[model samples]
Target: MNARTPRLEEVASLAGVSTATVSRFLNNPAMVAQQTAQRVQAAIVETGYLPNLNAGALASNRSRLIAALVPDIAQSIFNDTMEAMIEQLSADGNSVVMSLTGPDNRRLEAQIDAALSRRVDAIILTGIVSDLETRKRLKSQSATVIETWGLPEDPIDVAVGFSHAAVGREMARFLHGRGYRRPHLVVPRSGRSQARASSFAEHWMADGGEQPSILEVNIPSHFGQGRLAFRGLTDLEHRPDVVVCGSDWIAQGLLVEAQAAGVRVPDQLAVTGFGNLRLAGDMRPTITSVDIDGARIASEVHRILRARAAGEVLPSSLVDVGFRIIARESA
Candidate 1:
């Protein structure tokens, strides 16, 4: 019973299973039957043989792991945001797990189902859920569901993020203030990006500007696509004087494309991007972007989990960590 010497047999005896079975249940949980897993858990409670997650997760019950569902990990802004989120969660004694979603709708659905089967403690989803089936599956899991990056009218559970629609409105006003009448919205075809793109179009027209012309492309924000999407904007019967992008990745590509095309930025075509990544400031012309506070998002998520664990009803269902428009060289 030495404090430093915790024995598995004592825990096994308490859980009412052979030591060998306990070992498999903990190390190779997928091998244990569900009924047997519950028995081990009951014994552990009585004998106070608190086996770490290695055992219990192997048998049955929740995994002390939190899964962060990200569509693209290589995108610089999301990479940083997820890293901070994972760090903050791990510091609070939770294991951080990841499940990458592809561009395909069916693949994303399969990934969601697989994540639910694992029965993790919490689920953190990046972007909005467009697929109704995927959203239903996530809601059915009943875990601490969190949708970050964009806020929706009715989030399934908990959500912490900035409003993409508002981002568009503010950008239009900012452009108008700077004396830019004609604006073009360049965005990736992402779940949340569509919101920003559509809202930006409405807000820009409402602000007394002519109809907003939009250029939409695929995901991951590659430089080549940016060049193509922003191309011909200058030739749009009535050329747009400014461009707003879904993310800095798209903006970066737009900037590169504009430069290669011999168009001077800000002076010729002002560009604004979302998810103010570090590289934004370092870009040659220095991209002007909306700063979505990843650090604040991490802090708020941790605060919510702590409050929930203490049996307190979460006070903030919609947490706006806030966003800021950085006035840089590009815009």
Candidate 2:
């Protein structure tokens, strides 16, 4: 014979609370006193009680779940933001379901459908939603939609990110201020990188500099791609004085290759990179890169979610958590 499942009434009896109070606490702990909530939680653990999420969601219209969609999690660029977001959501008695959309975002729609079917309370995306039908569905749903990493002119609900084009323009000015005229770019063939590269080239030309050379590499960039990029640029008749890279891994690889080839960084060829990752500082010569504050972005996301839960309307739907250039030895 098998043991019977614990009942909600049994939990209420153990916690010395009414069945209605137990139900309310289970649905939203914040609605009950902290001391009472603690007692209920203890009783739940002691009784091995599992709340029926589907039934609770139907009653409260909230699943206490957030779905996070990212293009790639292997890269360190998104690590900090994700870690902070998960911590915050977990503290609020919410669970996070993450889906890797891959580099091409081909799995985005499917992931969204699955998340919606589960009645998630919120959906967080790493980039802007581009699909017309997906955007419309997200907007119509009760779930709060938040887009991160890039600021779109028209967000589905809310946006928290900096401008990629601004980052590119700032890098161009930084290189120009350092007196590097012949600059070359090595970037991954992604939308964000392409935006930065385009802005950098346009800014460089507008500032009376010659047209910079560009080399597009594959996504999920690694140090090997950077080394190959360096070799390719060196083989050109007009060697660039500086190389701007889309990622720190690529920049580090190029720096290593330059050292092996008897070329001095910042003296023979300066290098700059995006995503101010830890490796950028630990390298032989520190890399100059763009730094985006992932923690602040996460905090803003949590704040917005809390406000929405309280039935508060924000004054603005867009939040621009800006970026800065970390000036290091390489540049």
Candidate 3:
């Protein structure tokens, strides 16, 4: 006959404690005395007793699981924020599950449903939800939801992110102040990027400047798309003096293509990027970009989620992790 699995009651009996005390120790060791904790640990080791988390979850109605949704992690733009969130959540005795929903609303909706079915404690989304069905489904669910990256005017539950429009205005001001006449924007074909581009154009045009040249590519863009954008921009009748890219990858591509085409950066044409990636500084002519502190955003998100889980009254449900304009030689 197979040996029966040691139960929590058996561990408590061996450790000279009540079953409730053993369960408390398993859930939160700090709540138990040091001597009692040591004894329980020893009993667990001796009896090889493993806590049945599923059984505990069933009793408490808490899965202690978090699900995070991202558009695409291929470029690893949100890796720092994700890592920090996972680390902090793990410290709180929770596990994080990630899903790549890309840019499709259907895929995102499916993932959201999957997470809900698993009874996740919370759901972390990369950006604002535009799909009405997905938004409705999220709102109807009981799980805590947090939207990151860009602040949505109407958040599902809680929103923690920076303003993309603010980023655009700041970048425009920075470049215009640097004496750039013609400004052009190369961005991804997404609502967030388009919103930023609009803000930038409005800011530039409001100051008696010419209408900025704007171009966009499909989502999940790469360095190659940046090269294509640069080619298209240069071929235009009125070539831009400074170009702002949606992401650093695109700006890097622009730089590489410019070097190949004998275009002098910041001399013949100034260039800038967003996200403030590592390669932005390593390039021959470093790229100027916006620095959105992903780690700080993650910290704030974890704090809100943890507080809500603890039934703490929060001062506000919205948090804005601001951005900074990093100046470099590229612009």
RMSD of candidates 1 onward, in order: 8.4, 2.0, 2.4
Ranking by TM-score: 2, 3, 1
Q: Assess the local accuracy of residue 288 in candidate 1 as a C-alpha lDDT between 0 and 100.
A: 94
- Work out the TM-score per prediction: 0.80, 0.93, 0.91
State in Å the error of residue 47, model 2. Answer: 2.1
Better of 1 and 3 by TM-score: 3
2 or 3, which is superior by lDDT? Answer: 2
Each candidate structure's count of clashing pairs: 4, 0, 0
Q: By summed lDDT, which 10 consecutive residues of candidate 2 come out lowest?
A: 22-31
Clashing pairs in 2: none
Off by over 4 Å in 1: 1-51, 54-62
lDDT of 1 at 203: 79
What is the Cα-based TM-score of model 1?
0.80
Clashing pairs in 3: none
- Per-residue lDDT over 74-157 for candidate 3, one digit per residue giving the tens place of the 0 to 100 score: 885788899899988786668799998875434887888899989999999998898887788889888999999888888888
Cα distance off (Å), candidate 1, residue 65: 1.4
